[model samples]
Target: MGDTGLKRHGRDRRPGGNDVARLAGVSQKTVSRVFNNEPNVTTDTRERVLAAAQQLGYRPNGAARALLTGRTYRLGVVALGTSHFGPSSLLVALERAARSINYALSIANSFEDDPSGLAEAVDNLLAQGVDAIILSEPVDDGEEPLVVDVPVLTLGAAPVVHAPTVLSVRAAEGGDAAAAATRHLLDLGHRTVHHIAGPQRWWAARERLENWRHTLVAAGADVPEAAEGDWTAARGYEIGKVLARDPGVTAIFAANDEMAIGAIHALHEAGRPVPGEVSVVGFDDIPVAAHVWPPLTTVSSDNAELASVGLNYLVDYLNQPDSPPAPPPKHVHNLVIRDSTAHPPATEKGDTRA
Candidate 1:
């Protein structure tokens, strides 16, 4: 007496390849060919086999299939594992892109800043037999380069990795965005712009900082020392206090929207009216950016589109390894103007005031 009042057999009876073959009126090998995506089978035959498998709720054994095909059909993602807008948004986009291509995603997070942490994370993904890897939000830790045997795709700047095939796709150039924001402020009559930068270890942060400095120098504006923030509102608030007190500081650009929001709070508390006495701008037009008081002026990029392009390149390379590699395309960043920035106040003066 089985639990369901059905007779138990020596061999467990679940949906299997032979069951699908019988339902589809095809041979078991034909069913295997369909599951493996092998060619030479007629289109009608493939359709019938798939329909039968669906009807019988039959799923191919992935482990057994991988053993036979020498490919796992799985993609691995290594991320910073933070709730920050950029990394989190890229992770979601990667998952969606992988699913759309019939590939499963194995995500691993590196919480520590050390290179060993990333190495360990990559090893974990490799152990799962991912066909390719996507490194998201890579940072420099001043350690030896990482080596991987499979194709590696980087979301932003390329990390030091010794792999046969390395591809990089950026959502938006951070340097360009920073330059645009800084120029916008200068055009609005701010003598110089104060910067609140993200951690220097991350490449994106360095790019933004470098461009901001370059833009000011090119325009012959006095480049003030940039304040560093740890990509958090709390850190932004702390740093913002210092800048808020400097009455000469007429314009500020925070690395990202969260920090910008924090700066605004600090300014309000210090009785400095945004866009009135002081102007503020930020990077990453996150969902809440437009809803914040005075509506944040920030740099916006299409993270999902970037993810799709990177994933498609990886898939294409995997499918056609012998094809000549195509040069990566350039991405443009857009600046969204809002209520947070304006010309300097009438009483404000440039180097003379500070």
Candidate 2:
């Protein structure tokens, strides 16, 4: 860790575990334990070991660790490459969760236009020798399901790909959330609710639309034709202009916060007072939802918990690749009611205020 060890290892040699162990006054095995993130090391010992390693400019030998563990400890993800809040949040959650267990993450992105992107991404992860592959943030991909040799885990949807070893831990998606949002509108005395749904190809999008429709049907409410959107505010605004033209549209459920915000803007421009006439609900409870002029009421799921649970399932699959797909982790959906939603406007029946 000091100039002595540096001189001993020679100028050309790299600092390794021994130097860190000597500097930290711990055994070589302890240094290995600390770097490998195994249990039995105290907090002080771990910090001392890390500090010593840092001072010596020592980095763990990735190749050596892989050889010793017989696993790369890497989880590769094929995620939808967009700035959409939901997907972006899930990606960040996955990174944080992976690091907590001392694992590495590799991500491949597939755009909506790239149908064959998933296949190529699977091959790329396989080539990288990842322990498992995760399919996150489903998109409208037309490519045939992929088949790979390693374990595969998919979040928020079905197994878009097939693998000999498949975990397929279902991540919580839209069904419950959509139903909650739709029911919230119905409970407010809106005879019928309109929907602004995300594109149908993605499983998450389809789930939200299907659930919203089912909820309306279950309530014996009028089911209006839904407007499909591209998960973009611009698209939401475009669709909103059309919906705003109809006086019959008393309540609206947008698939995401961005769309809801866009719809709100369009409604305002059209001289429509939100909640006074058209009550709006959105999904994903994004940060801006609360700050908007009329605080948006929306549904939220824990992306961080979803990501952590998905990785743990992947780990289980790695340990037992042949086990049947496990029951989905328990997920909770929260509906935050705010000023944006209220009872429908007074008619001959009676006026019901917020």
Candidate 3:
């Protein structure tokens, strides 16, 4: 029992397949076959090899296997890194979908709206050798499309990457949703629907704004200048204050639920009752949308489904590179009518209800 050579070497050496084979009394090839799930090995032999691997704390080398197979089985995700509801929710769904397909996900955040930042992020992911890449929140930097060698999947309608393997899965058209919200307000006899728009750099925000304008024009409604917000309640509230003071502003549409909530707070502070005096609508029916005072009438997009469908398409491309590219599925949104919207105040019609 004096310092055995076996114990001394075991403490210092990293366990390998050879070590497991030695412990299991089998050839190294047999151990490798067992790990690789190749047929012809007896059940008992496989069990012994696995038990020996566990006892010795031996793990298969993924890098070695990847090199042999020429696939990393990893998906890289490029996101805006914002806490905004859409991007965050889509990321969660992407992770879950990747896991379900036995692939690993690596996420890199681009905090800036610069093309250089996006290029750097994509390069970083490529350096890590991901089999495929996903652009979760693609923004137009007013530059040429990004060039990538590997298969690329985008979660939105805009094509951010230009590659032979590029595929796009579209989310519900933001412009359509925005137009619906605006039309809802106008139909209620409001003169105009003011807008609290998200940052301009975001393609989603721009689409929402454009659609709002287009809808107003089509209906011959006044299109007031939109107030900009950074997708925050604070910014929404700041915009809200100005809107509340305007007696002609009887309806408002925010780009997201957080901004909508902030607008409601501003209206309350200004003694303007929601639905009674000013109706508010928002995009992205967030979880608290139904619980807020007066509740929120908003457009609900299936963000999780968008991620799942996009990831599945990427996986299909990975498995079948030669298959003719099929058309990407369209994501749809529904408008949820809640307590936050109503007809314009009756005071203008000389109908008073105390």
Candidate 4:
């Protein structure tokens, strides 16, 4: 009988340990070490073994290898199903970074508002034997972390269920930025700045709302009741039309770029002159941010950088499981001032109430 203790499944023709040893001209144990990436093998031997395995089309079975090394070498990402730019971009960045570090990724997109779906996605990733899970969803204050056997990482400011967390930016910093934008409008002498906020459940949205509120309050400007949207251009447009009609809204800070674009369109449709009558600011300086009639002034989340750092942190964690918990991932945010924002026009100076 063949030396492989496992039988090949139908049409699942992948070369195994024995096959790797035969090609590498070494014992199966040696091939096993090489495949596991264990240390102490001579460099020359490791190179030869890797070349031979590559030539023979040997692919390590993650499940079987997990049995041997106690690590799946697979990372899991739990993402939100919405096509919002931040979550989608973060997932793509994580996948690319995972590949860069020689790890495989398995992802599941969960609906942000569905608790059961989130639990199911977590269970599925665990079932596949992932080493850890990175959650891109904003933490649900009402929910507990899905009880899992693996480490869980939450990527936003909200308190996730007892899991390690990272944030895109400090809520305070985002608040500060919004306040600064408000101050900018204030300096330009607008009566006040109105907000088009994102979904209430999102940590980023909550934080931005808080900051915007604080800034307007500090500036002695009447902060209007914010309208909520799901961070879609369509929703932004809808709210934009409402804000456009008010005429008292001298300035606006959209929670994200797509919404900002929609808001701009709504302003045009309502016959309000942008910047001249209503200055606009947005968040997440996505590529389209600049393409709007006036290039957008917004913030950058450095999402790709966030992904790279998270993957590198996980790798380090894997290598040293005994180490104390790692510090939370650092989130960088910067303001990009472009053509979109300018001093509010002279007409709306006295009317702060909206």
Candidate 2: Cα lDDT at 77: 89
Give lDDT tens digits, candidate 4, residues 172-225. 333355666656667777777888898987777887788888888887879799
Q: Considering TM-score, where higher is better, how would the candidates rank from best to worst?
A: 2, 1, 3, 4
Model 2 segments beyond 4 Å from truth? 1-59, 169-175, 319-326, 348-354
Candidate 1: stretches off by over 4 Å: 1-61, 113-115, 171-175, 348-354
Q: Could you tell me which 10 consecutive residues in candidate 1 have the lowest summed lDDT?
A: 1-10
Per-residue C-alpha lDDT of model 2 across residues 157-193, encoded as one tens digit per residue: 6545667665554424554889989999999988888
Off by over 4 Å in 3: 1-69, 113-115, 157-160, 172-175, 349-354
Considering only N, C-alpha and C atoms within 3 Å, which residue pairs clash in candidate 4?
Answer: none
**Count of clashing residue pairs in every prediction:** 0, 1, 0, 0
Q: How close is candidate 1 to the true structure, as a TM-score?
A: 0.81
Find the 10 residues in a row with the least total lDDT in model 2: 166-175
RMSD vs true structure, all candidates: 5.7, 3.6, 7.0, 6.4
Residue-level lDDT tens digits of model 3 in 1-354 = 122124544476667888888888899999877765555789999989888887887877778768875878788998887888888988888898777555789998877456666777788999999988888776666666788888888766454567778888764455368888999998888878899998887778887898889989999989999998989999999899999999988999999999999999999999999988999999889999999999899999887777778877777667667888777777777889999999888676664532
Higher-lDDT candidate of 1 and 2: 1
**Best model number under lDDT:** 1
Residue 248, candidate 4: alpha-carbon lDDT: 78
Query: How do the residues 253-318 of candidate 1 rate in per-residue lDDT, one tens digit apiece?
Result: 999999999999999999999978899999989999999998999998778787888887787777
